[model samples]
Target: MQHLLSRSWTFFIGLATGMMLTLAGSGLASKPQDSPAFQDAARIYSILQQIREFYVDEVAYDALVDDAISAIVSHLDRHSDYLDRNEFAHLTDVTSGEYAGVGMELAITEQEVTIVNLFPGSPALEAGVVAGDRVISVDGQLLADSDAETLLMGMRGPAGSLMHLTVQREGEPELLNFALERRQIDVKSVSQRMLNDATAYLKINSFTQTTPQEVATALKELALAPQLSGLILDLRDNPGGLLDSALEVADLFLDEGVIVKTRGRYYEANVIYFANTGEKISGISIAVLINGRSASAAEIVAGALQGNRRATVFGEQSFGKGSIQSLFPVQPGEGVLKLTTAHYFTPDGLAIDGKGITPDRFVPSQVVLESLLTPIINPLPLNTVVAYQGEKKIQIANQDNQLRTALQALDHPD
Candidate 1:
């Protein structure tokens, strides 16, 4: 569905209003408008007037204008969009990495809204919400027909607000219910743990505003452990977020080089991001893991590191999403136009728009890894109950093939 708000919308409204005022003051026999700008404006103004005066039924003029404005931007590209007030607010919350909600990431799976991830220290995680749980309803409202945005809007609200949630879990005979309180959730994008005595693992969910700092903190904490010789940077399933966050995260392990470059028609969009003089974690081999779901900023990081010979990327080809979206706020507290502005390139000047980063070593199947596991740990838990942090690391290492391969590569670097 098309939404409303654009930078051009303000100028459009002004032009239409001016034309209407002029038309009202002057007679119908006034000379035809000579200027091409005036001619186009008059044509649009006439149509709007016709709709208001002769349409089959009465329609909200502002709503009609909003829709018209949205229609104008929708033709540009799939990524460019006009965000209405509510959507603009949601975008703000996402980029800022703070919102009042139960703090679970939801995805559409088999035509149902399913829980995919839970932020640490979140109400949903504490309430025993696990991945693969399908949402049935929120506060007694069924979500069979609700889109992800609608479901998110239903889930989020004022802090301290109470909400009832219903979900269907795998291997469970009955549906589960939880009374959850919406709290101010500060999303932690970087999750890190020591894979072994010598290897550190970092999983970046998305490149949020606070992600760079969170990554730095994780590296520092991991550094405290003895013999941290290797680092596994996991970007699998990361859909990417803020571009600056991605650049900073890539810079953390790089020492003086072009991290990534962007090129577009606009001069502001055509620029290169360079790493500073020093690396935070030196003398450590880095392994970056990516899959088909990894995209945008995640690809930027992988490309930068791969181009610089700083890390070996592992797994399937990444999601090719390199176009940049620049948000133009149309009105205060109203909405914004998310316009596609630029295309991203790796440090080596390889464009990543449609061509994703190819992994250095591609492992075709997780099933193969499953077969290789010892019988003692066979039959991994179908629905993992949140285990102790230490046990969780072991489970993660055993369950993911890409991570296991990266760990092996880092441990026995040739």
Candidate 2:
């Protein structure tokens, strides 16, 4: 009881003083100590003290402090959050592009955890767990009502830990069961494939610490230096990641120009990023594909490329999440506070906070391609899916109209 009261008093006193200083800094220095802001601060402390002393049941002081901090920070914006220890760890794992898990990219579809993609050489891939599989449970825990964060926490653990997964695959007679061992899953941020002899298609899942390097390496592997005619950079369904990674990726395509700018109350936040000299692959016509899911760092790259006329953006308007979040560590071994620090602007000086970036050409969702092209008889075999439009045949994993249109545009540039 003594320890709790003493700590609580200290916390409330410090909080009251901080509030007063903030009020003073905001041109209210001449106000009396009994001002509304001061009274509110005192009221908060009094309420907390009362709750601690006279509550119906025992309460955790740490939980109360955490809840107070969360309430204060989260009300600022939708992007800001008070990350708990687990949430902070998850953020680190994502930005680092590495974690101990089965290595399956998952999405919530109709309240079920569905596999979207798999990393190469991952435990999930080796176990024949393909995309479109729905994970019903993890280690005997039913994930029916779990959100993304809970699903991730349940999946990830110490390396070499054994895990069991129950999955529901389409056309399966019964639910598939698999026993897998957790391993270090190094997610590839960038994946590439050739659209044709001269065109290359690169899909970026998310920006991470290794994103720029992965992109550079993919370009090198394409070996299209002398013969490269066109490039398609796909940011479809990407939720975005680190801002620095986005800047570096944009730098690879731009010779020299202002990539993006940020504005905030602090001078440190108000800065501009400029591309360095030279392009990684010069003189190649570029097409960028974005959708409603593309945001933050993803939008940054698309806006930079589009504004500089280095690439033509297609598909749809990007997700408007242009606010910058900076992590402030609360204390050692505690959690961090993710605060919205600034609003970012495109190279054209346009803010995309609420209004997203409009594409140069709007392309609708997947199409049958029957009206636009002449139907040809399947020469390979039955049950083989192939994307064909007009006289050109583009081999794709799936029938994506945006990609098909982008390829056509790049093939015959306007």
Clashes of each: 0, 0
Model 1 RMSD in angstroms: 9.7
Candidates' lDDT values, in order? 0.70, 0.70
lDDT of 2 by residue, 31-94 (tens): 5778998887788889899999999999997789888987887568655557678766665665
Model 2, residue 10: displacement in angstroms?
37
lDDT of 1 by residue, 1-414 (tens): 111111111110001000000001111244467977679768888999999999999999988977887788868965676767776666557656777777776544336665656778888889998866888988888877664445556666788888898999997999999998888888777888887899998998766668899999999999998788999899876766677778788999999899988787956667888999889999889999988767777888899999999999999998777777776666666666667777778888887777789989996425322221324333223322222454432222225666767877887888
Model 1: number of clashes? Answer: 0
Candidate 2 deviation (Cα RMSD): 9.7
Prediction 1 TM-score vs. true? 0.77
TM, every model: 0.77, 0.76
